[model samples]
Target: MSKEVSEEAEHAPPKDYTDPPPAPLLDVGELRLWSFYRALIAEFVATLLFLYVTIATVIGYKVQSQNDPCGGVGYLGIAWSFGGMIFILVYCTAGISGGHINPAVTFGLFLARKVSLLRALTYMVAQCLGAICGVGIVKGIMKHPYNSLGGGVNEVASGYSKGTALGAEIIGTFILVYTVFSATDPKRKARDSHVPVLAPLPIGFAVFMVHLATIPITGTGINPARSLGPAVIYNNRKAWDDQWIFWVGPFLGALAAAAYHQYILRAAAIKALGSFRSNTRN
Candidate 1:
């Protein structure tokens, strides 16, 4: 009976991946529709809330640490603020817009053919605008304290070279996007759907872990929008000077992650090669 059960399980088909065909470079068919606008609005609001909460946490942490270096929430708390917000926001907006609060994540998915050019472009614009508004609110409410803390803008620390900071952002973002892909992979999701929190949890944890590693070097700009929002608002020479690293690093990292996840780790290329070899042998 045990042998029969093992055989049956082995022959059971793997969970299906429900991916549609790659969308065209431009999908103008839905450009005039309400659904598209609703999705964009969702992205906007989610990103806005995300930036507001996370940046506020950073500013608050700085204020406390200034008063008493050891009394404040410290690095761990800051990491949690960013990660926890991501987990919550993703859970709330996943159904509406795939919960891509980060431009790097959206770009990665676009490269992997998960979103169309039109959707990707619009999502990016909305996210940036949302980030700007979110930080703008923080600045408005905490005017005196806001500029003092650089408004939580990401910048390279004194000792770290530009190369080191850029590399850190790249690897950090790669971990994030890779986790997003793995967590949301259809095969994994189909099997794990009963545990609804499973998908967003790892993604949040990735953000937390990356922050822990890179905070000392570059204040951890794994999200370009997160970096840009505050940098633009702060309008400082240093923040703007170091801004290119945040965008370039995250984008390159995201592209690497999309390619790795879709082609290698997920075995699409390997499976194709294996099938080809088998047919030739037969």
Candidate 2:
């Protein structure tokens, strides 16, 4: 009788039979075909909106200076326009493609294991292309020689050296990326509680702050694409020469922030995984 009861128990279905299989880590079909295309389009459209509004502000300042001669929206205006546009676009597209208008953000997320390398590369290309289109449109409308406009390219002012310029960009981007990580973190206090009303606001303010601090020093290009647009159109040697700093500084800063968030802030999960591994080994 005991042996028969044991055999009956063994033959019974598992108690948690309703539990679903774990989702695939990567959906080859979606990642290769659908996600790639969707992410690219999202990047392109977001970047276009970013550059369009930003460059429009630049053109407005220039045109105003020429027309009004006395009163014009200054650097603050340009900064606000850029920052506001970023916030709006990010909120609009965050669900679609994570709203990474900057390559630095994409690379940072990739490093943090939040995104894949292929997606990052696709996003970067789309951003660059969108930037080119945005600035090209601006040039077409203004009929302004790219050279005279300096293509809205970023550069160190007369008093600043390359090192100083790079430092400014690094610091500026660090602030931007850090704020982005905080705002978008699903586990963050604001996000977890379902109170995300102020999420986009902080990001915009961070951009505004970075710009206010660095515009005078390096034109405040936390996004390389922002600089790329005007620089490519202007075809300025100075812009090209200084371009490396924009890419290097922002990327490093973003990577640092990502590392901090993933390793430091999320260390508990890492430790849990380690413990699980050790238990399995034992």
Q: Estimate TM-scores for all models.
A: 0.89, 0.83
Q: 103 in model 2: Cα distance from truth in Å?
A: 0.4
lDDT of 1: 0.89
Model 1: lDDT of residue 178: 98
Q: Model 1 segments beyond 4 Å from truth? A: 1-17, 192-197, 270-282
Q: Write the per-residue lDDT of candidate 1 for residues 131-191, one digit (tens) a residue.
A: 9999999999888899887789999999999999999999999999999999988877766
Q: Clashing pairs in model 2?
A: 151-230
Q: After superposition, how far is residue 82 of candidate 2 from its true place, in Å?
A: 0.9
Best model number under lDDT: 1
For model 2, the stretches where C-alpha displacement exceeds 4 angstroms are 1-28, 66-70, 145-147, 189-198, 268-282
lDDT of 2 by residue, 20-66 (tens): 23233344565657766887898998898788778877776876777
Q: Which ten residues in a row have the lowest lDDT in candidate 2?
A: 16-25
